[model samples]
Target: MTLALHRHGPDGVPLVLLHGFPLDARMWDDVVAELPGLPVVTVDAPGFGASPRPDDVARAVGRSAEPALETYADAVAAALHEAGVDRAVVAGLSMGGYAVLALAERHRGLLAGVGLLDTKATADDDAARANRLTVAAAAESAGAAAVAPMLTQVLGATTQAERPEVVERMRSWLAAAPPVGIAWAQRAMAARPDRLFTLEDLAVPALVLRGAEDGSAPQEAASTMSAALTDAEVVVVPRAGHMSAVEAPGPVAAALRGLYERCAQGSVG
Candidate 1:
């Protein structure tokens, strides 16, 4: 699938970032801007931005495999290999976090560190799974605008009440999202397995963060992940929500910068 990759800066171990559902690599622009010389690689997930849809990718060109985040991870690894990056600090938010975990499972050798922000290691409960399927059906039937109602749930109460502009921006993104991409991602996420075990053997440094006001990805979820990881710390971002990196880029950027510096150090890898 060789997802689209955008590189920034020329120093340090490359910090790879994955975006949440329906959003593309552009979501990381602000966070990347905050890190001056730290090399950064932002990837647009399958079917998002300029990348080809899953069924159109080289690996999936034939009778394609079922929708799975692991496929996306393989594409991510391929893209990195194409860019000549053998190792990197990988991070993600929401659905991106799910993909990050998939990559950790399938391509652990490529990870220097991991940042799990506003995400959980558990699989979706029956309710959540049904909701995802419902949303997928809606996206396929009505288009990306079907996810527009999710804006309130995705953003924090603080962001919704105090930063209407951010909410508006997200709304626009949602409206413009591709229906096929939305359906594929939603179904993939719904079928994902519980991945807390993925963190159990991860001896590498890890940063688990969640917005204090995040309803979607609770602090308990971050705690569970941090407890599973061998070497990890949890950071609670104030006044942010599921989209912490977007709601409050400063703290998210700082946390990511610290993680990159730690993993890029002479003694780590």
Candidate 2:
């Protein structure tokens, strides 16, 4: 479990961030900059960024191999432990959100707070699962280009039409994703189990964020997650899509900063 971890700030329980599929810790650069003095830690998912693929034993460093978010969560916990952090306000967006739940389910003691952004707590439906597997297979053969079509579904209409830079930026990230990582992440996500119950017992402050224009993770999903969380605040970023943090860093960062402060005060469960 040698997931790459990048820590920021000098002390305090850092806000640990997980990136969405096909992207790396760099996705949070804008949002992290907006965070000012807050402590932060960003880790690349297995097979993404500087981390090794689950099956890339030559670089796996340690632990078993599987296309499971539990594996990703374990790697995350291990990375943080190595960094001397026993607890943190962990947050994730899209695919990253899936791992966040896995962490909550498996390493509940490590969480100071939980943030779910542009993601759902349910397992992929039959069609969704099939599509993911198909894409994974295609990506393995065609490389990152196989996921390029997802660019349309990732950014909001407003962003695609107005923020050409952001769309192009997302395109580059998608294009730069490792083919093996892309395929592995798709399969892992497809095989995930329903995790709504995990949040029901989280007993930590939660933030459910969605993009007002997000087509992938709609308002319904956000509501379902908020409903499951005992202490949750739902925030919708306007003119943003599935990549809300990148599309609207100010709002996303503000929401995260609030969650961080709550966890820091140790005022909430």
Candidate 3:
């Protein structure tokens, strides 16, 4: 798939980051800046941002017509391989969080640990699946402008005046996303396997984080996963929402730095 990537940091244990749905790697700009001396890679998922959307959904999904998250995970692992990163810490936001868990499942040896930010390891409920389809239909019908308001509301409530910039960023990202890509993501998420078992199934270090204000992921999910994981940590970034990388980059970066260092040092018990 060859997703477009933005690289930062130095030649240390590589850290791969996947941005949330409807957003590209730009969402991690601030967080990436916080990792000063480690090799960092941020990728745009296929069909979003600068990456090309797959023309063959059936092929990607394997007869179900649903897009596969593994396909995107494969693309990410391929990108890391192309850059000579055999193993590293993997982190993701929202849909990217799904990618991280899939990566862990498919290539546990290739990951030092995982950071799941504002993302759940569970599969989508029926209501969530229905909502995604509904939104996808609307995105196809109304284009980027129609979804901008909801994007703003879902991200977080800044001051009334601060709303404009948030909406503008979302508008730009959505406008740039191909409609096919949006639809494909919706189907992919709907069909994704529940990865809560990934925590117990593998001993890889993990950190689950969410915004204090994030209604999407909620604190209960993080607590549940953290309690279940053999070596998992939970963090709540105050005053942040779904987009903590943007809303509170400092804590997110700090969390990444600590997670990476622990993984690098073999500190996870």
Candidate 4:
């Protein structure tokens, strides 16, 4: 599938950004400003945002041995190749974080570094997977509009309580997504293999950024990932929820800049 991509900056270290499920490349808009004048590539996931929906959601992500993360990673790799980026600092949020780790494992040669934002590397517990399946069913039946508000509430920090516009924007983004796409992503995520097995073998610099207020990727999960990655650093952005880039752009950007610059300068690679 030809994924829709948005490029920012004309020159700099290559960065491939993957968005979470139920949202698309546009979710990175707030973070993009901090990366002004730096080459970054952001793509909409298959069946999400501006990307085309797959005829069969399960098969689209990867019902095969490779799993969905591999397909999503390859898509980003292809996007980078098409953009003439031989190597990049790949970053992803939530579902995107899983994709980033998948890339690190399957295509390490194509990446200079990795940023896992508000995501976990562990496989979903049975209860979590079952819950996701339930969510997928609801999304398939009730539609994106119905689930969007609930998502906003779950993803936002307490500060977002008064931000009707933020919630509305999230709603509009989710509502615009095809129900099949959301459901398919949910299933794919639930079925994703445990990536913890691959972390101990990592050879690249890594950043594990979690929202201080993020319930999905709590501090404990971040600590576990940091412990697994020998060369990884952890950054906890205060006052943010799942959307750290949107909630605390400055700190997130600082972390990105530090990692990318260190890699570029050949200090950590």
Tens-digit lDDT string for candidate 3 (1-269): 36677779776667789998777788888788887887888888878777766544234433333477888887777767777777878899989999988887877777788888998888888999888888778767876544565565556665124656655766666667667677777778888988888777667778899988888988887887787788777889977778888777889999988888778678431
TM-score of 4: 0.89
Q: Model 2, 147: alpha-carbon shift in Å?
A: 0.6
Q: Write the per-residue lDDT of candidate 1 for residues 109-212, one digit (tens) a residue.
A: 99999999999999999999999999999988899877988899889999999998899989998889988789889989999999999999998889999999
> How far in Å is the alpha carbon of 247 misplaced in model 1?
0.5
- Which of the two candidates, 2 or 4, achieves a greater lDDT against the reference? 2
State the C-alpha lDDT per candidate.
0.88, 0.89, 0.78, 0.76
Return the clash pairs for model 2, or none: none
Ranking by lDDT: 2, 1, 3, 4
Considering only N, C-alpha and C atoms within 3 Å, which residue pairs clash in candidate 3?
A: none
lDDT of 3 at 109: 73
Worst 10 residues of 2 by lDDT: 56-65
Better of 1 and 4 by TM-score: 1
Off by over 4 Å in 2: 56-64, 267-269
Clashes of each: 0, 0, 0, 0
Q: In lDDT terms, how accurate is model 2?
A: 0.89
